[model samples]
Target: MASRQMQAAQIVEFNKPYQLSQVPVPQCGDHDLLVQVYAAGFCHSDLQVLRGQFGAALPLIPSHEPAGKIAQVGTQVKGSWKVGDRIGVLNFKNACGQCVGCRQRLRRTKRTDPRFCRKRQTAGFKHDGAFGQFMLADPNTTVHLPEKVSFEQGAPLMCAGATVWGALQKLKPDVKPGEAVAIIGIGGLGQLGIQFAKAMGYRTVAIDNRHEGRRLAVDVSEILKPDLVIDSSAPDASDQILDFTAGEGLAGAVVCTDSIEANAWSLQQLGNGGVMVPVGLPQDRWQFDSEAMVFRELTIRGVYVASMGEVEEMLKVVAHHDISSHITTVDFDQIPSIVERYADKSMKGRLVVQITQ
Candidate 1:
């Protein structure tokens, strides 16, 4: 029998529009699942790839956040995973089982953690991603989306959702119930962070410069009940944050923007011995006060994505808290316009492509 062909959108050249073409359906390898993508999210990383910011290889399929139903299951995949199962794909598409990240995590944590693996490749960059009819997914990185969550909501959870969840997880044990944490950048990731921080019982403060961002932060404060929403563009921004926290300063802060200045200020807003978790990557290197970091004993940490276990845990939290992504849906062919909106800073919320039913 001839192989099946599926439609996909690919970046044929850097700084150019994606070419929509038909490609063969990816075969399901052992420990892999073939998913008929229902929805795929548009991310800043995808924009970076289009603009040649990361120098990623050419002809790559962008959009790492995808959710769909299983069309085929590898023979090695056991029990619950079967054709027709609703699932979401993780960025860590696959990791070598022999790598330290996989083996050590399996032994110690009783789970497969791909974050530490050197050979692990993300779905959108290293392999074919889900801006298509079908995508091959590693079983280890796939998570079951809850029944109530729509494909659009579940898709962003794979990337933006997981990223913030992993960053917030670093606050455990240190951030007490009444302590405050500030989220800088009220975009897609920051919005989710606000929801999660509030649900986790932390006094949440949101910071952003755009009037829309400040408005969204205040909306979060009203809906999710965050403690304060500051306009970071204000000259007295840092003072406002300190004042809100009663001069003790934030117990910790998550830098969700790619601005180097925002990152530096995020570190400065932290109280003594506070943790600064940076989730976004900047084109330029971040320069902070070395002496202040040493004197305050502050810790700077970068969280990329959650481990496999962490993804599952985050899904549970989303389900329990009824968390959802604020998104606008577009057809698969509308990516170029969305990219333009992204470049012009006009996109109000996350953009998700409806790939298939």
Candidate 2:
């Protein structure tokens, strides 16, 4: 039997550090699974949540990216899911299947995608999330972790990897194989984006203004590394990208950074009718030249995390390509320091909190 109480790192107040406390284990609903969290990822969104940007309820646990084993299975959940099964959970929970977003998703994909459901309570925002020993997860948005993927890697894939994968999927119809694709940021998400793009057979180019980011891109394994790493701050960076693409510019650009300047600058590097997907959530409003957009026929598509089916596909791709997340694992109690590191943007890659064996 699971313990009634578990250790958790919680935000007792807004714009304050997390407080470690013993909280009741979240009850598993009829349509939910009780997960014994093994690893939880720290995301940029977590920082926003700490700052109260997401209007998260106080005294809430704070990590949305969690990978774990099923401690108990709900009777209402009819599937292969059983206790002891390894899984990774998406942030959205208890999606109302009758809503317009859900119906539209069903109509188009013939799959009940909960990602677009407005009635869903986002983990770490409206509801208690990971950073605890256990959490309740909806089966609709949960995915089985691959044998080759560890909990540390799976944690970040729940958000960072899935977000980029979904963004690249948006460009599939328009961008052809061997076409140029630029991934801006070169951070955790950007690193995974580069691998996904490469695995998809796109000529991937990594762009970053920071020296550390540029170095990280270059340091990736030969098979997964981008075809070219460009300094986005360079005066001739756009020209360099254009030249690489035979003066046609990039076929697709995925903006993984939250910098508004990087977002606007990415538009200039796209070819005619090229698509740009913004995966970052910046507080500031994004501005663009209307004439340039109209003349170039540039496209901007905003994407959230991947649908459940897409997330499964992403895991398969990760397994097949041996894709991995560069992570720094910390003990659960070090959650406060992790927040500080993230706030200052001092971390190299994803940060994961080891919760259990």
Candidate 3:
């Protein structure tokens, strides 16, 4: 039998901060895996959840990206996974299996069940999440961790890495090799976006409005050997782009910034017929003029979270690609403490917390 209580972070109410509490451990269903969460990544989304942006499923355990060993499994589960397997938990836990979204996504992906499958329980968002010593995950969405990657390295991919990877795949039909691709916001997601875009053989451009963000963008560019890294924050920014692309504009722009202004400018900066993909979430409205859409014929796309199809592909990339997210690791007890800090936007990088450590 499982322990009656475990360490968890509770979001007692919206607008107020989270409080660390010892809560009853959740039980697994027939198809669930009682996972011993060794590592879990804290995301900006988690910060949003804390700020009551997503609103409380009250007392949320806010870690989505997690890597851990399987402690127990319920009946009806059968696959490559077995007891003690090390795997990465994905962000979207379950899509409503009966919905059109799930039907379409299920038809498109390898997993039998959709990760957005709302009918079942989720690790972080819906039910109890990964901010505890043990988390219940659907084995269908779990990606086996490679020996080369630590629990921390695998953590971010459970969400950020997969999100960017899936967006790129959707943009694949339009993105040609050797084309110029720009990414806004050099934060955690943007960092992985740069690497993924570079790996796809696109000439990458990393853009940021801040000093450290620019430096981080440049650092990724240098390592990934992107064609250029532009500071949109710098003076003469558009002029710099005009020279770089020679009035042709960028071949494509992945607007990881999610800000209306940043995304709008990036969309306007795209070349004729260029693809503008938005991966970040914004609190305000998305303002885009019809001219940019109709006149330039730019393709604007927004991706929330990746479907199950992207999980395996992303894991294979993580296993082979020299991809690693810059992260700050924390212990499970600090979930509420750190979540409050993130809500204010003062913290930095991918956050990976170990529940069992």
The C-alpha RMSD of each candidate to the native structure, in angstroms, is 1.8, 1.6, 2.4
Give the candidates in order of TM-score, highest first.
2, 1, 3
Q: What local distance difference test score does each model get? A: 0.84, 0.90, 0.75
TM-score of each: 0.95, 0.97, 0.91
Listed per model in order, the count of residue pairs whose N, CA or C atoms clash below 3 Å is: 0, 0, 10
Residues 10-36 of candidate 1: C-alpha lDDT, one tens digit per residue: 988888888898888888898789899
- Model 2, position 191: C-alpha lDDT score: 89
lDDT per residue, candidate 2, 153-249, as tens digits?
Answer: 9999999998999999999799998999999999889989999999999999999999878877766668989999999999999889988999999
What's the C-alpha lDDT at position 37 in model 1? 98
Point out the higher-scoring one by TM-score: 2 or 3: 2
Best by TM-score: 2
For model 3, the run of ten residues with the poorest summed lDDT:
110-119
